[model samples]
Target: MVLLKNYISLRDQAEIVRICHILGVGPGGLQRPGYSTGHKLQLHRTCFGRNWNQETKCQERYNRDGSIPPLVPPELVSLIVTSVQDARSHVNSHDELPLMSPDTALVNFYTATGRLGLHQDRDESPYSIRRGLPVVSFSIGDTSEFLFGHSRDEDKLKNVLLESGDILIFGGRSRLIFHGVRTIFPNSAPPSLLQKLKLKPGRLNLTFRQF
Candidate 1:
């Protein structure tokens, strides 16, 4: 539940968009599970050292199976991991943050009408779960109404507005909390950002996790 507002600058945001374009971030780029046909959001995924299978919903160290692409650039991974660790250290000196080296990323695109249902990120390996690694999430483009609840009760959900350039880090006691994107605000993106990235009205989210 730790939020860093405007954590990334406009220049950095545009750079990330460029990188995503180079890496590919559409239907043909990363294939989601066939069962996700009914889902509203579109997703593009990339792995660092490990790859996740949406169909089987499992993660494994990458191999030459040709099913998944290679890991994201090391520089990008370092930027995210370093930022989260530094932020956590500033909050509590003895917070016992896990030594996190993110190996997977889920890039999700949401239109004004797109929404993500409440869910927990519990697919990491047992070792990762035991260590309680944090999930680092970044937002670009439109703003979103993010819902998070301690349990599965929708009535107890707390709402938060996630704007472009915002970063969210949840772990430790807050890890595994039920969370989802309730809705997206149309035309909420920075005009310069949309033009620079040549994007339509939508939000792009990048979540980093360890496996």
Candidate 2:
């Protein structure tokens, strides 16, 4: 079963598939970072596209050129902004996700035997720029161990199981909360999603921001 409703959850398999497919269309599009024990710390500080200069805990950009599509997509920006219009209906509602206005979505992928460590997404300016705004994150594919911490300190973290089709939104007091993926249960995916991703052990994370 899934846990960690505040930051992650199991979502609609079909819609998750569609989003994953569409994510690759961008030039410096989404990424499937080869996971390693360092993945969590590495990605937490990694920067993508054109925003590296600003990240406090930066990581290598997914693209070879270290460039990415804009933090905010011009054409689909509006649609993405409105994507969470009904967010309030969900567990982590819109009213709490203030950054929903300038929604920027970043896709990160993890493959077999991959694991991510505990960390926080405090690099994006939105977390501080738009006060009290929460970042909306979506997870699909194989299950993984998720951790949430009150701060960067080791003693404050809590672990949870994150399954396919999960949606996580952290805002308000939880906005700056520390979180990250620990380990991916490789080869444990549902056959259909595995097929969608070519039957590999992996999970795609899409984070929405209001930039």
Candidate 3:
């Protein structure tokens, strides 16, 4: 696992917010995700490059609404790649994660009440899974209480505060660890960001990975 604090500049973060707003207005954009049991998630989601079917653990070009999802922006792709490479330098050579050609981005916008139950990101191909390709995640806006552990036992889970402009990457031996968002801290976003983007009270998370 690797954590880079304030890695994204304010200017770049603003640009990303703009892009998200633009894409979120179209079909197959920012909508509540639900489980197979019909329980709606507290957060809204939109996909780029490829849409993910959570229940099936499959990737599709079209979304549930039968509309094509937007392509992942070039800037985002560049950011993801660069972040991973930089993270690689901070770890020991033996634990360095494999560089992946990420072609899918899952964007989630979470409110103060948002939370995600513990889960493992294992939907990628067997080869990708075997290589321990990293998931490059960017956090913007409000802070989140992130939980991670080898097992589902809440007592054993560790917590981390993911703030705006933070980047979290986990792969290699830690790729299959269970993780999730416990909650979002209210009024924790940078004031300038909220004013500039006219954003609501929430955090925007983008996870880049190869499928």
Best by lDDT: 3
Q: Which of candidates 1 and 3 reaches a greater TM-score?
A: 3
Q: How much does candidate 2 score in TM-score? A: 0.65
lDDT of 3 by residue, 14-44 (tens): 9999999888887887889887899898889
Residue 14, candidate 1: Cα error in Å is 1.0
lDDT of all predictions: 0.74, 0.54, 0.88
Error of 2 at 139 (Å): 0.7
Q: What is the lDDT for 187 in model 1?
A: 96
Better of 1 and 3 by lDDT: 3
The residue-by-residue lDDT of candidate 1 on 42-156, one tens digit each, is 4434444455555566555432244455576686687787777666764564354555788787767777887787889888878777777888898999999999989989779
Q: Estimate each model's TM-score.
A: 0.85, 0.65, 0.95
Error of 2 at 165 (Å): 0.8
Q: In candidate 1, which residue pairs clash? A: 47-71
Candidate 2 local lDDT, 6-118, one digit each (tens): 23222345555554555455545443343344333223222223333222233334433555444444533453344344454554544555545644456667765555665
